[model samples]
Target: METSSRFEAAIKKLYTAFHNNTLNPECCKQCAVGNILDNTDSWKYLSDDHGNLSLNYVGKVHQTLGRKFNGYSPLELLQIEATFLKACGFQIPLNHTNKRPENPTDNDILFNGLSATISLLCEIDNIPNVMDYQKLFKYKKTTFDYIVH
Candidate 1:
């Protein structure tokens, strides 16, 4: 498969895993590692360089959900988690940002719950993925060794 296509597939796999609640914390960590391996060069841009990609991803998620997660609520964390998953390359429709929400659907609830758990795991563990690390600390001057080791 082409590089872009491979990346898309990986994103879809992660999305599916998150949506299904079939992905454990270790699985998400592995996914993050795989993403780093696949997009190592992107890390240079995310860290010690351009940090806009991380902002874009987070902004897009917040914009879409119409709320900023305070990092305390599981639902908010899930939205952020889904955004991270989409950053892998799922092509989330940004145009849906302003849409009205009648009620949270099952898929929405599932994704939200899964994202919350995933986000907590990511925050607490060593995400061995360089890209993930970059996204998490792109604006900071801290070295990778300090964050990962």
Candidate 2:
């Protein structure tokens, strides 16, 4: 499948899983990207030794993507994935946890969706270099600080 379509399918799968409360360890094993994200490598890349993304984090992730995959830079791949995940109601940190705050913001339908989407996107071996689409999710922030959008 093409990158866009593959990404869309992955986002849909995540959206479904997110609402269904299926983004747990059970599903991660079956999910290509989930397995990767659950491990140390993915976290270490993003977290690195600093324990958080640095000023050059985007560049670092872009470089990592280039090394791991044959096509598309990090921006090209994440732009769509990020947008779709936000639209599906995923907050970055909330996605990683099984529990959430009492009230759900526009964000934090949970990161389950974003995490799944990212994980699946990583599974794609070679994304096309062409930048066919560019979408950004402009979500307003509240007290919650861990949001990726």
Q: Considering every candidate listed, which one attains the maximal lDDT? A: 2
| lDDT for each residue of candidate 1 in 1-149, tens digit (9 for 90 to 100) | 22233334444555665555444322323333223233233222111212112335544445466652222222333334445445333333222443322432335644543454344344433343323445665684765655665
Clashing pairs in 2: 33-119, 94-111, 95-111, 95-112
For each candidate in the order shown, give its overall lDDT on alpha carbons: 0.37, 0.41
Clashes of each: 2, 4
Candidate 1: list runs displaced more than 4 Å: 1-3, 27-149
lDDT of candidate 2 over 1-149, digit per residue (tens): 46565455555655565566544322322222342233223323332322122424754756666643223343433333343334344443224453433433223545633554454454553654222233255577779568687
Lowest summed lDDT over 10 consecutive residues: which window, candidate 2?
Answer: 46-55
**Per-residue error at 33 for model 1, in Å?**
4.6
